[model samples]
Target: MGLLVPVSVMAAPPSVGSVSISPDPAYTDTPLTATPSEDWYDEDGDPEGYVWRWQKYSTGISDWEDIADQTDNTLDSLYFIAGDQIKVICTPFDGVESGVDVEATITISNSLPTITGVTIAPDPASTASTLKATPQGWYDADGDLEGYVWRWQKYNTGILDWEDIADETDNTLDSSNFVLNDQIKVICTPFDGTDEGVPVEAVIVISVLDYSGSIDVKPGSDENPINLGSNGVIAVVIYTTDGFDATTVDVSTVKFGPSEAAPVHYAYEDVDEDGDTDLVLHFRTQEAGISAYDTSVTLTGETDSGTAFTGTDTIKIVPSKAKESVQGNEDAPGQNKEPGESATGKAIGKESAPGQNKEPGESATGKGKNK
Candidate 1:
């Protein structure tokens, strides 16, 4: 009978009646003390009390943790914030026990601050990326923030990682001149001093790639071959990669005849109609050199983008030994006639006028003279 009682006692040990949280649904930053108690199966006539234990059952970890053993009745205080599960684990007088763990939720507020406006000087930040700028700006929220950071990308090729720049705390530019092709980024920083900040960064594109052009001269066989008298047209065409024109040539610098001297030349361009401007030389060569004078043409010019380019071109003017008056050929008509003989006729040929066929009765000069 004792053995049978032992078996029955083993079969029905204890069960938990109730376990309650002192305060349900915890709030953020609140502290709570949990106390757990259980009802016994042998409350009325059982000989021995049931064994009991307390455990902490959390959602993430895969093991049950014992908070209290059969010899102890310890209360645990839980301090939690937002989305934590609270469970009062207990061993009851009954062999069949139950746990009361409720899923709880709370609010979490992020007090992280944001960086606001950024201001730069000397020009629009985007106007020159490689510019030296004193970085300055404002921020949102009164929370403590340190400095800012940003990735400076050039032309979208990749990050200029080697160009790691410091966060600007105030408006003051460093002495470093920007690279010819460098761009800029304006980042606002606070004093917490870490590399990270709530950075308000603006991208600046530096645009100082200077482009320029000018004119040079080279004389073709037909170009300016005729001499320029004191005010004659020197006929100088300025040259570019594109083509040649006649405006930019300063004729005043051309020294002909004998003395090397500067000439005055003006430029006129039909650029509004077709293209850019060029210079030409117009001067009269003094009659000192009957032979064509060989020399160079010089141009003094400043580029469209402010570059100075001076170029000289070699040219030759064929000389005439003596100035001769050109007269029409008057003796060709009598070459084909015999001595002292007169012949008057019209031939049907290419040299004849239209509608005159040299018919049988037609006279050469509309007179009675015949062929």
Candidate 2:
């Protein structure tokens, strides 16, 4: 015997028996925690500091990739997809040589789901108009889209906040309640047998049309242009029928004819004392040079939303007078005598001279007796 010497052999690697992965049939893009069985052991009974290496094999690339490596006995699953295979191995070292890798595998049976795109048929939707939410490009890891729910919401400007559409749960919205520059958002969520998944969201803007108010010409408005007196005050009453605040009417949009005029005096009050507020505006007709004999008094204005409103009334002007009067029936050279009887009961072509009385049917050319 050639000096028979007993040599010490290095212990074998630790066997990480079975890998228990919570949610084995995990959904794609969802996290799953993997825990190795406690039956793992090193032949030398020194498994401390054993290295755990996790690897993944993707069907898309047909290759194995090293995902993570640590001393811990657990693996945090991330970004796994259907037909993807994952494995964890433990290597134990006996101070000098490394042992074999004892491994276990877990295959992903499901994939991730997603809502790729969303749209509105008429993106800039109008108030009281139908708005339909069209969801496009959806993917279900499980290849099913039967259990999906949706909700719509609007950004409110009054309180400067978002308001949920309580009564709307369908994919199509009818008679949308939108204001100018309204931001609308929608959310879609997945549900599977009473289990709810994460939700996806999309946003769109609603362009509402501006509001236009109806107008009316107040009573006593002259069909003919009435002469403007020295004061030149022309009173106007605006009947606001729009949904906008009349008190906040845009002064720039308020115009008389083609001329612009600042409100000399304006108030939304009960001018007629009828207990109802009326928009009253005063314009200096003379100052605006709108005292033409015949002119159209065009009242034009707009709301804060830039909607146009207009009212027009025709009028005619005349010479200024303290009071209207009837023509006199006095006689004069080359002046035709009054065709009708005078107020004093004198017939036509007959008039009394000063301090004289004329008989009925007597010509004024004839000498009449003095009264």
State every prediction's TM-score relative to the real structure. Answer: 0.24, 0.35
lDDT of 2 at 147: 62
Q: After best superposition, candidate 1 residue 60: deviation in angstroms? A: 30
Worst lDDT window (10 residues) for model 1?
325-334
Give lDDT tens digits, candidate 1, residues 1-371. 35544344334444445445444544333444444444434433444233334454455686545554323333333333234444444444333432333221222222233445564454533222324434354342323354443333233337534344444334444425354335555555533332244555555544332112222221112232443322222323343334223343334433433343343333343211123443433223443232444564444443354332344444455444311111101121111223233211122111222222123445422211111
Estimate every model's Cα lDDT from 0 to 1: 0.35, 0.53
The reply for model 1, stretches above 4 Å from the true place, is 1-110, 124-142, 145-177, 187-198, 207-303, 306-371
> Whole-model lDDT for model 2 versus the true structure?
0.53
| lDDT value, candidate 1, whole model | 0.35
Once fitted onto the true fold, the runs of candidate 2 whose alpha carbons sit more than 4 angstroms away are 1-18, 21-25, 28-112, 191-197, 210-371
Supply candidate 2's per-residue lDDT for 133. 70
